[model samples]
Target chain A: MTRIAEKFVEEFYNSFTSEVLTAADPAEVVDRYYAAEAVQIADGIEIDRDKLIAHLRPVRKNLVSWRYEVHEAVREQEQLAARFTIHAQLRKGRMLSTEVHLFAEFAPDGRLRRATQLTRDVTPQTPQDVTPQTTEAAPQ
Target chain B: MTSRELRVLGMTCAHCVNFVTEELEHLPGATAVTVDLPTGTVTITSDQDLGLPQLQAAIEEAGYDLAD
Candidate 1:
C-alpha cells in the first residue's frame, strides 16, 4: 500500500472502532482516522461515510473499551487486506477477544472506496490451553 | 473428533473474527478453528464432545449470535 492508502486505512479502522464502539463522534473519526469517502460493510449491510457513522452510534453503546492489534497487512494493487484481533468488554460484564480479516479497496484518487469486515472470536487463555501435550505419563 | 461449520451473526471486521476464534479455541475440546471471511463461516475441530450452550454464550458475549 502506498503511504496515502495506508493512512486512509489506519484512519478508517481507527475511527470505525473508536467512534462506533467507544462513543467517539464522527468528526473525531474523520479528523483522526478516516478518509472522507470511506465505506463500511458489516454482515451484509453496506454504508457510505454518513451512514457508517450513524450505524456505529447505536452499536457503540454496548461496548466499554474496544481495541485491535494488527497481525498482518497485505496490499494487492487497489485492494488491501488487514488481519487483526480485537479485545473488548461489553456493558454486561462480558469480555471477548477475536480476530478479523478486513478487505479494503481504494479509489482511483487514492481515497478509500470500501472496507469489509469478517470476524472470528477468540478467548484469553493460558499457554497450556492451546498447546498440545504429546508427552504422556509413563504407565504407573 | 468431529468438525462443523457455524455462521456468526453481527460480525464485521478483523476484530470480530479474532474475538470469536480466540473464545472458541479456549473451549475444553476445541482442537482448531478456521474462519473464512467472504463466506462468514467458522469451522471448528474438536476431539471431544462440544456443547452448543458454551459456544452460544461465548458468541453472545462477543456481541454476536450463532446464525440458524
Candidate 2:
C-alpha cells in the first residue's frame, strides 16, 4: 500500500475514536473526512452528516469503554475498503461488539464523497451451545 | 407479539449480525436480539407488536434483506 493510503488508514482509526465517536460536536470531524455532499450509508439507509450525528449521539452518551482494531485494509484506485472490529463496553454490564467493513470512495482531492459501513456482532460458542440431551424421548 | 424469527439474507459476517441486531432494537419494546450466524437467522424478543414491514424496512436501511 502507498504511504498516503496507509496514513489514511491510521488517521481513520484515530479520528473515529477521538473526533467522531468522542466529540461533543461531530460536525468538525465530519468535515475533515467527508465532502460537502458526502453521504454515509449504514445498513441501507442514507445517513447524511446531520443524521449521522443523531445516530451516534445515543451511543456516545451510553458508551463506557470501547476499542477499535483494524483487521485489514485494501486500496483500489479511488476506493478504500477497511475491515475492523469495534468492542463497546456499555452500561449495566452489557457489551456490544461487532466487526465492521467500511468502503469509502474518495474524490480526486482525497476527500470522501461516499462511504458504506457494515457491522456484525462477535459471538463465540462452545459445547454448551448444543441443545441439552433429554432423559426421555417425547411421547408419541 | 412476544417474539419474532426473521430469516435474513446477505448476512455473511459478524458485521451483518450487528446490522441485523440494530434493526431489531429499533423496533418498539424490543428487549433482546439473538443472532444465530450459522443459520442466518435473528430471533427478537419484544413486548410490542412486531410488524413484518417495519422489520423489512429497518433491515433494508442497513443494506440487508429480510426474507418475506
Candidate 3:
C-alpha cells in the first residue's frame, strides 16, 4: 500500500506538471485528475475547477521547466498524503523551489475529490541547476 | 508540566494532525498534545523537557519535519 501510494503521488505530479505546462488544453489535464466536484485549498485559499484552469494559464505561459522530488508519501484508505519539493524554472532566469505538504481524497473513480496543500518557499541549493527545457518556447 | 511549542512543516490535513499528535503523545513524558493543522503548530505538554532530537525524531517518524 505504501509503495502504491508513493508511486501514485510520483506519477500524478509528474504527469500533471508536464501535461499542464505543455498541453494545448490544460483544462483537460486538470479534469483528468480532478473530479467534477473537486476542491483544492492551498494555503487557505479555495480553488475550484474554474479557478484551477485560470491559474494554469499563466503557469503554462511562464513556466519553463519543473520537477518534483517526493520525500515521503502514504495512504490510508481513500486518503493520500505526501511531502514533496517542486523545483520550477521560469522564463527570464527566475527559479522557484517550494516544499509542499499535500493531503488529498480520491473519489471512487480514482479522480481527486478534495485536496489541501501547505507550501513554503525554500532556497534552492544550486539555482543554476535545472531540468531540461520543455518544447514550449520561452517569452522573447 | 513543561509545554513546548514547535512549528512543523508538511502537515496539511486532519490526518496529518492526528498522526503528529499520536506520535507526540507517545513520548515518555508527554501528557497532552495539541496540533493546529492550518498553522502546523504543535504544543506538547510533558513532564520533562524534550530535547530537539527527541522532538525531531517523533515528528520525522510521523512523516513531517520541523521548520527551521
Candidate 4:
C-alpha cells in the first residue's frame, strides 16, 4: 500500500539506532518494527530476526553516534529500496562511514519481513593502472 | 528540487560518492545526495545554504578536498 513508501522507510531508520540501541530492552524496538520471521542480509551475512536482535544487543556499549540518511528511495507494492549513508562513531574513536543500498519486503501487517543491505566502505581510490585520459591525435 | 554542485577530488567509487553525500546529509535541511563520478562532482539538495566552511569540513572529514 501507499504506506510502504519513503515515509515508512524513514521512520524505520530513524527509530532503529536511536530507539533500539539506546533502549534497556532493545527487543522492544525490534519487535515493533520487524516481523517475527524477518530476515536480514548484510555484507554476505544473513541472520534471522532473533539473531539480528542478539547481535545488536551490545551496540550501545561501544557506540558514540550512528545516523542513517536516506538518499534515493523508491517503492512498489510491498517492496522498498533505498540508497543511503551511515555515519557511525564508536567510543574508542573508531569511526565508520559507508554507503548502503537497502531493500526491504513488507509483511501484510506492515512490518518488515525481509531486508537486504549492500554496504561499501568509504575509502579513497585504490591505486590502479590506468589508460591515458586523452588520446594524443597525430597531426593529420 | 534545486541543487548545488561541488567540484571535488579523491572520490572514485560509489562508496566515495556516498562519503561526500553522507557528510552533506548531516547538514541542517539537507534533503538529498547525488554524486557524478565522471565529473568528480557532488551535488547537494537543501533548502538552506550550506556555507562553504560547512561543505569544506564535510569534505575534509571524508579525506578529500573541495575544489575552489
Candidate 5:
C-alpha cells in the first residue's frame, strides 16, 4: 500500500506536468488523471472539471518547464496523502517554487475523485537566483 | 471526561477532518472528536488523558502527522 501510493503520487505529477506542458490537448490529460466529477479545493477555493480545464489552458500556454519533488506519500484504502514541492519555470525567465500538502480520495478506477491542497511559497534566497513556482492559480 | 487539543499536519479539507475524527473516535475511552480545518487543530474528549503515542498512532493511521 505504501509503495503503491508513493509511486502513484510521483507518476501522477510527472505525467501531469509533462502532458500539460507539451500536449496539444491538455484537457485530455486532465481527464486521464482526474474523474469527470472530480473537485479540487486549493487553499479553500473550489474548482470543478471545467474550471480545472480552463485553469490548465493558461498554464499550458505559459509554462516552460516544471518538476516535482515529493517529500512523502502515504495511503490508506482510497485515501491518499502527499507532501511535495513544485518548481516551475515560466516565460520570460520568471520562476516560482511552492511547497504543497495534498490529500485526495481516489475512485475505484484509480482516478482522483476529490482533492484538497494547501500551498506556501518557497522564498528564494536571492532575487537573481529565484526558484520556480507551481503555475496552478488556486494557491495564489 | 478530559479534553485534549493538538495540531495535525497535512490536513487540508473536511475529508481529512472526517478521517482523523473517525480514527480518534476508535481509540479506547474517546467520546468525541472535533476538528478546526483552517487551523489543523483537533480536540478529542476521552474518559482519561490520552498519551502522545496513542494520539500519534491514531493521527498517523488517519494519514497525517501530529504536529510537534
Candidate 6:
C-alpha cells in the first residue's frame, strides 16, 4: 500500500474508536464515518444510521472506553475490506470484545458514502479429544 | 419467510464476523444471527415476516453476497 493509503488506514482506526465510538458527541462522530444511509449491524440487529445512532446512543452512555483493531486489510478498487475486533472496557473491570468485518467505500469527492459494518461475539472454544470406544466383544 | 445464507466477499476474520452480525441484528424479528468466520456461514433466524429481498440488498450494500 502507498504511504497515503497506510496513513488513511491508521487515522481511520484511531478516529473510529476514539472520535466515533467513544466520543463525547457520538452522533456527530458517527455521522463522520457513515453516510446518511449507512447501515449498522450489532448484536443481531440491523438499522439505518438514524435508528442505529439512536440505539447506540444509550449504549455509549454506559461505556467507559472502546477500541478496535484492524488485523487485516485488503483494498479492492475504491473499497477496503478490513477484519477487526472491538473491545470495550466498562467501569467495573468488565471487558467486552467482539469481532467484525468492515466494508468502507469512498465517493468521488473523497467522502464515505456507504459503510456496512458487521459484528459478532467472540467466544473461545476448547479443543476436545475424541476417542472411539471399542466393543468388549471385539477380537484382538 | 425464507432464510438466506450470505457469504460475505470481503469477510475473512473476526472483525468481518462482527460487522455482519451487527448488520443482521437490525432485521425485524431476528431471533438469532451467528457469523462463523472459519466456515464463512451467516446463519440467521427470523419470524418469517421480514423481507428477504431487502435483507439481501442490505448485505450486498456491504459489498457481500447472499451465498446459496
Per-residue lDDT value at A10 in model 3: 67
Off by over 4 Å in 5: A1-4, A126-140, B1-68
| Residues B1-68, model 1: lDDT tens digits | 98878887655555456556766777788999988755668888999877788778866655567888
Instruction: For candidate 2, report its TM-score.
Output: 0.55
Mind giving the per-residue lDDT tens digits that candidate 3 earns over A13-127?
Answer: 7777777876889888888888999999987867788877766654555557777778889989789999988776764455667788999999887788899998876746678
Model 2 Cα lDDT, one tens digit per residue, B33-61:
99876666888899888788887887776
**Among these predicted structures, which one has the highest lDDT?**
3
Candidate 6 lDDT by residue in tens digits, B33-59:
887665567878788756668778756
How do the residues B1-68 of candidate 3 rate in per-residue lDDT, one tens digit apiece? Answer: 89999999766444355557767888899999997776779999999999989999988766677999
The most accurate candidate by DockQ is 1
In candidate 1, residue B34 scores what lDDT? 88
Instruction: Give the worst 10-residue stretch by lDDT in candidate 6 chain B.
Output: B9-18
RMSD of 4: 19.3
Candidate number with the higher TM-score (2 or 5): 5
Candidate 1, A5-122: lDDT as tens digits: 4444444555455544443365454433445777777655565666555434334545556555567777777788887766666544456666777888877655567788866667
List residue ranges in candidate 6 displaced over 4 A. Answer: A2-10, A21-24, A41-44, A123-140, B1-68
TM-score of each: 0.47, 0.55, 0.61, 0.55, 0.59, 0.49
lDDT of 5: 0.74
Q: lDDT scores for all predictions?
A: 0.62, 0.64, 0.76, 0.66, 0.74, 0.57
Candidate 3 lDDT (Cα, 0 to 1): 0.76
Which of 2 and 3 is ahead in TM-score? 3
Local error of candidate 3 at B6, Å? 36
Which stretches in model 3 have alpha-carbon errors above 4 Å?
A133-140, B1-68
**lDDT, model 5, position A56:** 65
Per-candidate iRMSD: 6.1, 9.1, 14.2, 11.8, 15.3, 12.2
| lDDT of model 1, residue B37 | 55
